[model samples]
Target: MKIATYNVNGVNARLPVLLRWLELAQPDVVCLQELKARDERFPEQAFHDLGYDAVWNGQKSWNGVAILSRVGEIHETRRGLPADPDRTQSRYIEAAVQGVLIACLYLPNGNPRPGPRFEYKLRWFERLEAHLGTLVSLDAPVVIAGDFNVMPTDIDVYVPDRWRDDALFAPEVRAAYARLLKQGWIDALRELHPGQHIYTFWKYWRRSFERDAGLRIDHLLLNPLAARRLKAAEVDRRPRGWDKTSDHAPVWIELSDKPVRARTRKDASSHR
Candidate 1:
């Protein structure tokens, strides 16, 4: 099963690029962020025509999230994080697709440190930590995919010193991200290519993509149940180079149909 995440930046403006990628990638499930459109403005039909059923939480001219599934009907679980600092923003949406829980989020960028936006970002992280705490230990597999908006570690940034004062690379923000991983969620990309300088986002300025100056702010995290089935994780960078494309590329992961069973007299075998 292939699951992918992409921050389209502006769904309507990038509809063509998005549709093109969807056709090419053909992911079984997709989590999209930064729709930048209202619920009524979401081009649901565009996705349906591609054999995808989508559920989106949208807000006007700002953050929004959606989950698209082609493998099965999407059973929406929730639309927002519990106790979200600002429920007005459409940042989170969860659904069950093919027996797996998929969480799509577009975390706050929290630019301009030492300000209310930054404070709000931290508060949002607290709520996420509180809510995800209930999910990490679940017996059912869970996949959290989105633009986390934080450079988790120095390696996740193009240059640690260059972004030292940036909100995305703030020490507090990075610490919060680390805390999330401590909950037993595997960083899918890092798990598969720990030493590689992999990046999913790049600035349009200064020919960032052309120079390979980018950041790994986008991520797909898996719970232990799902981690055991992880087969591949990748970032399709071609789309990022396209004209009128989003700064972010799509990140995806392939999972085995079922978890590999443990060695035991009654269950010493792979499930798929």
Candidate 2:
């Protein structure tokens, strides 16, 4: 199966570009972020017409997430992160598509740090860590894919020093992400193309795309069960150059069909 993630920026504003990319890329499952629309405002019909069934958690003019499936129905598992009861931002959504547990997320961009927004961003990471702890206990094949809004390493960004103080490259943010990786989730793209400077997002200002000034903030993190089946991972940078396109491009991963056997009671008992 092929799964992809793209931060569309604004579903309505970039509808045409999104449609064209959907046709060209044709990912079997897609995780979209930054819808910037309310639930009622989501253009379900447009995606439906393209043979995709979508479930979205949205809010007006800001963060939102959605999962689109082509093979079967998308069953909503969760609407938002349960760890933060006060989190009203529509930045996350989880669903089951073709037996795979998928999480679509749009992490906060805590710019102009040392303020309330930055504090919120750190607190959000704490919530995400808590959610991940629960997810690991399930031991199910899970895929967390989205625009993380974080530059994971120097290799993930065009110039690490230039973005030192930027929200995406913050040290604390990077440490939080590292903790997530330590929990056994594999970074699919990095694993596939080790040491490659592949980027999924570029700033619109200063001809960032043209100059190849980009960052690999978007990602696909898979549990061990899913990681074992990962066949390939790539970023479709061409879409970013398209007319009225999103600042981000689609990051996709292909997985093998080898069924992941569930751990037996005996196996679980042995671990204890």
Candidate 3:
């Protein structure tokens, strides 16, 4: 099965680019962020015409998330984080596609460091960490994919010094990402091509894409069960160069269809 994630920036504005990429990439499952539309305006029919079933959480003129499946029905498991009762933003959406538990998130871009937005970003990371703790224990196949909005390491950005004071490259933000990795989730892209400076996002300013000045803020992380079956991971950069495309490209991973066997009491006893 092939799963992909893209931060579309704005679904309505980038609909044409998104449609074209869907045709070219042909991913079995897709996680989309930054819909920037209200719930009623999601354009679900368009995706359905392309043979995809979608579940999305929408917010007006801002954050949103969605999951699309071509070969299987997408059963929504959760709409937002467990403690998020108010549902202030449409940043997270979870669903089961095929046999994998998929999580799609658009983490806040904490700009203007040492401020309210930055503080909120850190708090958000805390919630994500708490939520992921439960997921890791499940030991079932899971993929947490989205635009993380953090430059995980110095190598993840075009220039470490340039973004030193930026919230995305802040030390605390990188540390939070490291904590997530410690939970046994494999960074699929880094694992597939280590030591390579691969980027999934490029700003429109200063001809960032033209100069290849980009950041690897988008990510696809696989839990242990899914990691074992990871065949390949890549950033489809062609779409980033297309007309009216999102600043972020699509990142995807291919996994084997064979499901991870559930651990039985008998197997547990044998190991003792």
Best by lDDT: 1
Models sorted by TM-score, best on top: 1, 3, 2
Across 25-134, the per-residue lDDT of candidate 1 in tens digits comes to 88999999999999999999999999999999999999999999999999999999896647799999999988899999999999889899999999999998888878
Give each model's whole-structure lDDT: 0.90, 0.87, 0.89
Q: Model 3: what TM-score?
A: 0.94
Q: Where does model 3 exceed 4 Å of error?
A: 259-272
Model 2 stretches astray by more than 4 angstroms: 259-272
RMSD of each: 3.7, 3.2, 3.5
Q: What TM-score against the true fold does each predicted structure earn? A: 0.95, 0.94, 0.94
Worst 10 residues of 1 by lDDT: 263-272
- Sort order, lDDT high to low: 1, 3, 2
**Candidate number with the higher TM-score (1 or 3):** 1
Tens-digit lDDT track of model 2 for 52-89: 99999989999999999888988899977876766679
Q: Tens digit of lDDT per residue, candidate 3, span 234-262?
A: 99999999988999999999998774435
